[model samples]
Target chain A: MMHALILPLLFPLFAGAALLLGHRLPLPAKRGFSLLATLALVPVALWLLLLAGDGQLRLYAMGDWQPPFGIVLLLDRLSALLLLLNAVLASFAMLYACRGDDERGPNFHALFQFQLLGINGAFLTGDLFNLFVFFEILLISSYTLLLHGQGPARVRSGIHYVVLNLLGSALFLVGVSLLYGLLGTLNMADLAVRVAEMDAGSAPLVAAAGYLLLIVFGLKAAILPLHFWLPRAYAAATAPVAALFAIMTKVGLYAILRVFTLIYGSEAGPLANMVSDWLWPLALVTLAVGVFGALASRGLQTTIGHLVVVSVGTLLAGLALGSQAGLAAALYYLLHTTLVSGGLFLLADLIARQRGALGALLVSAPALRQPLLLGLVFFAGAISVVGLPPFSGFFGKLMLLQAVPPGPDALLFWPVLLVGGLGMLIALSRTGSLIFWRAEGEPVAERADGLRLLAAVGLLLGSVLLVLLARPIIAYLQATAAQLLDLQPYLAIIRGGEA
Target chain B: MEAVLAVTLGVMVTCGVYLILRARVFPVVVGLTLISYAVNLFIFSMGRLATGAPAVIGKSASHVDPLPQALVLTAIVIGFAMTAFVVVLALRGLGELKTDHVDGQEPRE
Candidate 1:
């Protein structure tokens, strides 16, 4: 049964390695291998999700070693949820990229698999140090992927992106070592136990370590002061890669959510709710900046970039609410944001191509082919993005706004959720009308890539599906949030037979 | 010995930060390399200052923790790979953009 846990990590590794070994193979073979590998992950993730659906937590110990001594991969509702989300997005990205995006680079298929491996490993690992290792894996793969087409813009952004993450990785090692030095264990469950019994004298140092780790997570999650690297990098990346990169930020959010609740929640005295205090103000600011940047930016790709930042801001703010209601709402919001954002990136690419010289700018340059159908596609994503009713974003925003209790945070969270969302709605309308509503010049006769448009539509359908499934999904997320608040089972599974 | 090592690591990181904050790409890369070295040593120090002892432990023997040593070794290899990647990325950016400043600005003559 535990083999299910290891399979997600290993399958991708082997798939990537296989692709690498068959470098001399034709495109169809490489593409087939990559697609098969990604498609296989969905079922595995679903199986794991089913196993963990009823709050089951499974721990797989590598080399038969016990916790605190050897690496362990954990599967719970949260990891399972994220793994499924990742697989779904990877499948879409693969389908979209299959239409020649992969041909831009020889090693695209291999790197794609490796990126999945890294993402899955990051989601699954229960040890703090292991998280750092997988982070490096993902970062390295992303570094190459962002430079996939090898353009100057990508290279510039890649340089900044790599440098920033490298610094973050450095801090990660420092924090991990500090925590290990203090607690004598790198296993998160063990650290939770040790942290509970921590001496008063060492509390400050432990808090500092927690703060350092949060800073690292913040950088990855694009919390302000550490977010400059993201917009440009996402904007500079090729569309398909940018679409895939949408899920990458959520990995950081997952880490933050995991580490905060597990290692420092009520289990660890004094440090409980440590980062949440600071997260509230920081996240609110991040949300504001993201929305404002969106309204101010004219380019469609840049708008998508800032829109991502907005999602991060809103999700992080919900998380900082530090209530079960808030977390469940955030999780719900996170789901649609990923789907809608990824769809929009692909949509933006198609629009840019259709507009020819204008390239996704919010100006009337030429009429796009299939303007009405594509206009509806943009409307689908736009309404969801702007948090209008009957869409996933509306459901998520409503839940989030209603979830915050009547208190100090509600004061801030309410206004930001309302006004920031309003900002998005206005920005979307302006951009939509500018490009789609008015046709001021001759239509650019770029041949429509039917497959790409269909893929973008498929992404839009996913957002609609989220709305249709909102009740059941939100119910599941509420349970997942409750499970996160309950760390006892996770600890017991890691401690094994003694429990 | 611990004090000496701590100070050395601190100095390396300080110098690395100063270099990283510079406008040039080359300095930033060098800074990243230096910072990585400090980080590697920091991870090694988690096992405590390894005195004159081989990294082998008998059933009850008092030996230094090899875990962090192994972790540092991994970090070193990754750091090297990252440094190489960044240097190449910087060089490519410079070649294409006609500038070597980290933000791609042409330096004043």
Candidate 2:
């Protein structure tokens, strides 16, 4: 049990350290080592997913210390799903990196593994301060990775990304400190128990802590007002990095859902509805702003960057509904968006490579050498992104709409989602023609590398696989959502006094 | 001790925010360091302000809870690392763009 519990963290940490040591090796050797390690995590993650899929929360107390006294890694269905998601993205991103991006800078593979370690640790840790530590680990590594294959544009955006996240980290620390001062416990399960036991008088302090946490997480997740840094930073990152980042934003959302639901959830007086009330309005505006930004974006990657913002908005809006139905929809949408957005980022990179000087700019380029193949792939990617039928995106939106109960807020949500898709359709069409259809001169692009094409196509297939396996997948997600909302099992098993 | 520490933290944070909002990169770095200092103190204060409390496990009637101290120590190390990384990044930015402006430079006419 301890082996399975600690394996996820140890695997990446050791691999990353080894990669750092072997930095003097040839590029191919380095890439191969990193690739094998990342791929190996998939099965480990899957086995754990199956183990936890039964809805039991497996708590691994580190150093054999009991709860509230030591750090712990808690595995539940939701954590398993996210670990699997991270593994899938990490594998594909590794494949994409091999096409040329890995050689863009030194120690790319090491930093990538470190980033994954931080992400997986953040997902699994049961201590709030430990989460803070993991968040820093991820952010520090991201700072370096963001600056990889350094360019003036990358550096320019990297500065803003670093400063904003530093501020967010400070806020996170402050929030955690506030909670500790008030409650004297840092273990999440213990905090939940204490919160439930608190009287009405302490509600205001919890609310302060809750709002501070919301602000920090809101910044990380790029909620509307705090979202100014994402487009520039994401657009400037290398393709594989950007693709993996599709899950990075989800980390913030995951933290929000996990903490808010488990600890400060409605079981805690006065803290029950704090985040939801503001979340709906903010999310609606986020969706609107994201769509408009996408429409205004001049480059293909920037447009995809804004599309990421749109997906975050969509997921949060569903979460704001605060029903089991809404959570189920959000979970499904998370899976859908991560894959499609990841594929689109890789697709944009492939398109840029083949398009020459036009370089993913929204303008006429000479005809691509392999138009039919690339055209077909891009069309599929665009359709999936806009949530057309027969793709996971379509089903995701359908579920969200179904989950919304008949209420006046439905008027606001329905229009934004529908209109946002419309805006997305127009943007997609315009960009599609600008690159693939407006061919006029000689065929300027060299044929793309076979491996890169295979990776991109495989991602699109992964999305399709979601469609094919919709039955079991949605069932799994619904179960995951159900487990997430029920705080009792998590509370009982890990509480300081209960056991 | 409590009121004095609170006022000090408030002053540090206010000044830090001001420096962080500056246009140049260096002051922003300093601002970040300042804010981190304030946050470090805030975390330390969670253990309460204790006088004549044993850092050891000696049988002092009210030993200052040493957990937050250990946490703040770790946080300080992490904070220093962050400051160092940003400083190098800011220097590189200045060298590359030939400007210290955070936005790199004005749009070329």
Top-TM-score structure, candidate number: 2
Relative to the true structure, candidate 1 reaches a TM of: 0.97
- The residue-by-residue lDDT of candidate 1 on A1-499, one tens digit each, is 3688998998889999999999899999888889999999999999999999978778898997977788899888889999998898888888889888998878998998999998999999999989998999999999999999887778878888988999999999999999988888899888888888899898998888898899899999999978888888888887878888999999999999999999998788888878888888888899999998899987888898999999999999888887889999999999889988998999988888888877887877788876887788898899988889878899899888998888887887889878998999888888989888787776766665888887777776787898788778888999999999987886676466556
In model 2, what lDDT does residue A156 have? Answer: 96
DockQ for candidate 1: 0.79
Report, for candidate 2, the interface RMSD. Answer: 0.7
Query: In model 1, which regions exceed 4 Å deviation?
Result: A494-499, B59-61, B107-109
lDDT of model number 2: 0.89
lDDT at residue A101 of model 2 (Cα atoms): 94
- lDDT tens digits by residue: candidate 2, A1-499: 4569778788899999999998999889988889998998899999999998888989898988888888889999888889989999889999999878998899999999999999999999999999999999899989999999998999999999999999999999899988998888899988888888887887798788888999988888888998888988888999899988889899999999988888887677657767898899999999999999999999999999999999999999988888888998898889889988988898888888777787888888778788888889989988887889888889989999989887888877888999999999998888888888897788877888888888788887877998999999899988988887788887886553454
Q: Top model by lDDT, which number?
A: 2
- The lowest-lDDT stretch of 10 consecutive residues in candidate 1 chain A is A490-499
Off by over 4 Å in 2: A496-499, B107-109
Worst 10 residues of 2 chain A by lDDT: A490-499
